[model samples]
Target: MEALTTMKKKKTRLVVRKGNENIALKVEDIAFIYRDNTIIVAVDKEEKKYLCDRNLSALEEELDESMFFRANRKYLVNIQYIRGFKSFEKVKLEVSLLIPTCNHSIIISQETAPLFKKWINEE
Candidate 1:
């Protein structure tokens, strides 16, 4: 039983179209995916950031929700980058990330917990 759990580590996969070519990006390779106002950015190896012409919500729809969590209204983060979560207040939490997050500290409120849980449950 424990062997099955150890052997079945979950992973994420993303299918994206770049310059007329279809590229598949593994979630582990992604540093983070964030939103700038309405634009979405996917940062990967070599510190290269790719711009997706879609909004955060739209991009989130294309992603495997289990691996990417919408921490705030403007940011969707990969769980691989999630270091730990701290209970900041009675109904809020501060999430620490593994990567060097520019916009550090995410508050997970009661209102957002369900949505966060849903995202974590998806593929």
Candidate 2:
């Protein structure tokens, strides 16, 4: 007899709420996920917002690591949506995205700046 091993499949879609309806949104279509006050919101490439039932930490673990980067405590950004990044206030980095976010800016801390650069350059 041979032993078998199994690997968890990464999530391709997320169930989100818009008004009273639950929508099945493709992970590829999501530009970013952010904490807006007490709610967890997922924004698509087109800038539409949906409510997520799970927290950011849970979503980070479930989503593909290569595709999503935990930009900060409040943001989980998609690599496909990153337009560019530049040095900000010396040590920090300001990331620009294809779709605008509610905060208007995504700032990566000095501690995470190097990691962000490496991840962006890898792709």
Candidate 3:
């Protein structure tokens, strides 16, 4: 079990597209990932949004579970970048991130809310 757990590697960086150029960005700098229209976008703490070739689901597999959480189908947010959260629509939660350009809120479903709270509180 220890061997298998140790074999699980965390991604250190990602190659993302910004306009016509591809940029190698540190994983720790990413604030969140989201699906916009047919494109997948990654936002950094600097408030810059980048185009990712991989979709949200694929990004989820590559990201470290300790740092990122899927708020919903549309968002996978970095725990360190989360500003706060508030209760919404009875059982749901609306999460606010620290990124200035990323103004939209991420919502967690009732079914996933408890798990999100646990993740946030764990470390």
* TM-score on alpha carbons, each prediction: 0.63, 0.90, 0.91
Where does candidate 1 clash, by residue pair?
A: none
lDDT digits (tens) for residues 1-123 of candidate 2: 123322456799999999999999999999999998889999999899999999999999889989999999999999999999999999999989887554558899999999999988885
Ranking by TM-score: 3, 2, 1
Q: In candidate 3, which residue pairs clash? A: none
Give one digit per residue, the lDDT tens place, for model 1 in 1-123.
999875555436565455666567776677667777666777764445666666777666666667777777867777766676756677776777666644545677788876765665565
What TM-score, to 2 decimals, does candidate 2 have? 0.90
- Report the C-alpha lDDT of model 3 over 10-50, residue by residue, as the tens digit: 78899999989999999999998899899899888888899
TM-score of 1: 0.63
Candidate 3 TM-score to native: 0.91
Q: Rate the local accuracy (lDDT) of all candidates.
A: 0.67, 0.91, 0.90
Task: Give the best candidate by TM-score.
Answer: 3
Better of 1 and 3 by lDDT: 3
- Model 1: lDDT equals 0.67
Tell how far residue 73 is off in model 2, in angstroms. Answer: 0.5
- Model 3 misplaced stretches (Cα beyond 4 Å): 1-7
